[model samples]
Target chain A: MAENQKLCPMFEFAFELLGKRWTGLIIRVLLDGPKRFKEISAMIPGMSDKMLTERFKELEAAGILTRNIYPETPVRIEYELTDKGRALKPAMDKVQDWAETWLTPPDQNNGE
Target chain B: MAENQKLCPMFEFAFELLGKRWTGLIIRVLLDGPKRFKEISAMIPGMSDKMLTERFKELEAAGILTRNIYPETPVRIEYELTDKGRALKPAMDKVQDWAETWLTPPDQNNGE
Candidate 1:
């Protein structure tokens, strides 16, 4: 807030994690529940598979989400939020609230 | 959340506005109060003047903030968040809360 008051490095770090393109949308989808790779990809229309895969690895390495592998006849993989990831719900909700309040629907912007 | 449930275009738009590098920090600084250009730039380290100027224009165009010119000997200018920008406080606070809870202090992570 002040020139003398240092910005929290942790807050900066959080942005570094969540503020990238497609990252927030990925988290928003997961907020519903655990999703398979295809499921996650399906919900976000524009994200490339390569970017999604990279984000998955980053979230995994950061301990936000876990990848679970099922040893069925064909292996089934599910991605679920860790405790750390679930803790992000409140923040995500706030963003959603703000978005709903301020942003217009893309389709309705013909007049703009 | 569901694959069938379309992601809100508004949310995507909000992210498009806020998710850029240095944008959040600029908003965070202004959340304290209105500030002159130098004051805002002073608060955020490592941000170039050019980038700050660019973000300021973008924010103004988005109606997130306003630029006020005071007619003095030398024109005094200040940037203030509009109601739209002020509405972002709750969301920013939530992020700050999550960051404090989850992210390690930068200096303490020497072992990592």
Candidate 2:
């Protein structure tokens, strides 16, 4: 049987990464451009510092984000999307479009 | 500032659902067509029944999947994608395409 006969392993792996909580949001936040750790954290309210740090590390390891460290006395770190990461913008935009069309508020569905 | 000045809430909600474990796979499996519970279970090896059941229920609630039950003596249940769910195929295909291009196997990166 052809390898594509079944579920594509690579697709599954990508989904595995994107499916994680905060991962997609992190990517969305970074879409604007590179941002410092604190800046990204501020955009995602209620996100714990530990979780953000862990997710950033994971994204960096996955090659989705590039982390730059300044050589100054007080080190400055910023995260930016790699080429591969930027390619995901199309998929993310599609999801956003689908959500707006299909997902309505609960109150809108019923008389409240 | 315009409403689009910041992250869209609808996009966040869709990502929240898609980012869950097994949810994407479930959609992938159903892409072919409606399948019986056992059929889907067989296709996705290693998936626990409890987990599948839970995911299916959640998908139905999310309006992504429609469950059909027969009125025969022994009931038969099949799951099919709703219009919204089928609409996600484009996004899913993009993800699969991206995976093939960017997600090279670790072994391929170095001469092992």
lDDT of each: 0.79, 0.79
Give residue A73's error in model 1 in angstroms.
Answer: 2.2
DockQ of each: 0.40, 0.39
Worst-scoring 10-residue span by lDDT in model 1 chain B: B1-10
Misplaced by over 4 Å in model 2 are: A1-9, A107-112, B1-13, B45-51, B107-112
Interface RMSD of 1: 3.2
Tens-place lDDT per residue, model 2, B18-98, is 766677788988999999999998877767989999999899998899999988779898999999899888877777678
Q: Which residue runs of candidate 1 sit more than 4 Å off their true CA positions?
A: A1-9, A42-51, A106-112, B1-9, B109-112
TM-score of chain B of 1: 0.82
Model 2 C-alpha lDDT per residue in residues A1-112, reported as the tens digit of each score:
1244333556667766876667878898898999999998887776799999999989999999999998887988889999999988887777767766787655555656
Tell me the lDDT of model 1 at A72.
Answer: 96
Clashing pairs in 2: A19-B19
